[model samples]
Target: MAGTNLKCRECATTYELEPRYVCEQCFGPLEVAYDHSRFVDDVGALRRRIQGGPQNIWRYGDFLPLDGPPGPALRSASRVGLPAGCTPLLRADRLAERVGLGEVWVKNDAHNPTHSFKDRVVAVASQRARELGFDTLACASTGNLANAVAAQAAALGLPSYVFIPSDLEEQKILATGVYGTNLVKVRGNYDDVNRLCTELSGEREGWAFVNVNMRPYYAEGSKTLSYEIAEQLGWATPDRVVAPIASGSLFTKIAKGFEEWLELGLIEGSVPTMNGAQAVGCSPVAQAFDAGADVCRPVKPDTIAKSLAIGNPADGPYALELARRTGGAIDAVDDDEIRAGIRLLAETTGIFTETAGGVTTATLAKLAARGDIGADEKVVIVITGDGLKTLDAVRDTFESYEIEPRLEAFEAAVEQGVHV
Candidate 1:
């Protein structure tokens, strides 16, 4: 009653907190359900504790499901967790103007240690895995999660196995392997890898598949993003938040974070509407939204936004319900628009993001153009990863001019309208 428990999102069946992510009754996804009565009646003390704690997600430890004090793991002669959150929330006036909005902000999560928001989830998963007596950790990743899990496992000195699609970005593959974890490349897509991991999870004992067995704890990590955003925005919630959808967990977690804040009296006003973006080539959730269907039909992914290419999203139905309940819309854009989105964000905010971020940015523009998002509303676009990881997506989208190191040659190139 004091701590947390696993609650079925569908049947409301509650179970004792354990290394489980799915309910036995309805086979629904399990979520961490905290007893709000444990929180102190004094909001000021809570606020001060959060503000004065570590400069990371641990500052909000009370909100997370962990044993004892929720701190980072002391491994590799250093700390391994607690540094994955507290990313900057930049006031993107330039981006807002370009998107025809009165105000905009970018929750730049690329600043995480692993250069993606996955670090937050992996940090918690690694810690929880160790606490649950797991000496090895594993997951089925697209790209960013592989980099994050491998890096975090290395830092924690735990043997890790990451299953990824064979055709993931070279940068992601190299980065993940550099962590020295066992990297498995499947010939099939992410869904196939995920299925294999699920099978492996049932076969292997003491191996905590972060996104499988320890998913409830792992997913709780994403709530820190919403907490950080509200704290950075003067303890207020934004009117809208647009995030790219892969499995749709992050999107729903953001909404849940805001609701928790309101329940705890940590923030005022209603929760923000949740907008989701996806690449057209792999947009099951967005397609479901467009067709007014509650179920998402899986599609074969063929987009440069590989990070957001989970065709069979586990949280697709919940994400769709949240979007509709909040009066928000889900949309998809083609590869060209995704590339243009990356350029537009870079030109305006100087933040180069991965193709998933590009999808979110471009979708924001599309929503703005259609007057779906009001021009006078305040919006925050979530940039989930750094552009450096997916450089191939933009390799042919821009060009640089070569000139001799002479003043005349430079002048000639400038006269020819060469990009500076």
Candidate 2:
């Protein structure tokens, strides 16, 4: 287990690390807790080891629940999983200018193999599933996760079952089905599909539902994003980070990652402000934060950001606590604002992010406008998925000029502010 154990988030009890995500004693969420001493005796040694390891998430194998670093045999594309992580952290000077921030950067996870941040989580879960003797993989996804799990399972030669809302983007559905998995389209939202998957976990033997059963390991994948940010910034933490909130796991895990690095003396700065973004149509976590309450009130999703439409966010309370404790805030934006955000980012930074990214970007702008974000503070916005997957959200929002293929027609369109 690499000296890692599963510990209850609410209770102080710990158990052996396994394919477990819920505590048997208190039923609280189980998280991977590590014995940090095993990974390093000193900060310099840890840095060297991590720097010398694999370029992907495996570089931090010492912190993960893996048996060891992935062997050389598992390095290529022909193997079980494609290398995920170490995505670019771009300096968005133009985006910063547009968003009214002194400095802004983007940890663009759209570059991942599945074109979403879900690839990182799925990679860890799939590897651990193999170790735990599970030959099949399954998940209830929004869109990005469906693509990641299905593609990863196909890569590993595992039969997979992926459940999703029937109304997800066609690009995402096509992407998942092409991976050759048993793609099941449920006629409900993500939470509904998730509930059904939980029921099936008990009935279906020898199947690993990545998000439902292997969540502890799966969620740990998000910590790698924080690690990459710190390393990419020359081993320093940012002043603030804005992340989209769906199930709230990513935002909380990012806070966890920063804490872990600070504990290990890898980074010296105080924890950054942990802000969250959500669509107004499904902003339970944001609403709870605004009300100064711990309990998130669920609402049926009615937003174009289907990826962030988790009405009942699983880690809502934890995310709310982190935001409050870190002196940060959570905010929500409407669908029109989210669309504007998508165009703003692509126009300013040339990063075509999906609706989740739109939520984060739009919320960041709102925060900046409200003077919540300091003009000199360094900020990083996490872009979780690619815009290509959700083209429907912005298809009618744009126009293509049907003009004659002549220089005079182009000049007239350009002069009249028409599409050229």
**Maximum-lDDT candidate:** 2
lDDT of 2 by residue, 1-420 (tens): 553688999996998877778888889999998878754468888888889877788888877787764754565664548788999999999988987789999999999999999999999999888888988999999999999999999888889999999999999999999999999999999989999999998888889999989999999999999999999998889999999999999999998888988987888787899999999999999899889899799889999999999999999999999999999999999999999999999999999989999998999899988999988899999999999999987877778777889999988887887873
lDDT of each: 0.89, 0.90
lDDT of model 1, residue 51:
91
Error of 1 at 294 (Å): 1.0
Error of 2 at 256 (Å): 0.6
Model 1 worst lDDT run, 10 consecutive residues? 73-82
Model 2 spans > 4 angstroms off? 76-80, 417-420
User: TM-scores of the models, in the given order?
Assistant: 0.97, 0.97
Which portions of model 1 miss their true places by more than 4 Å?
1-3, 69-82, 418-420
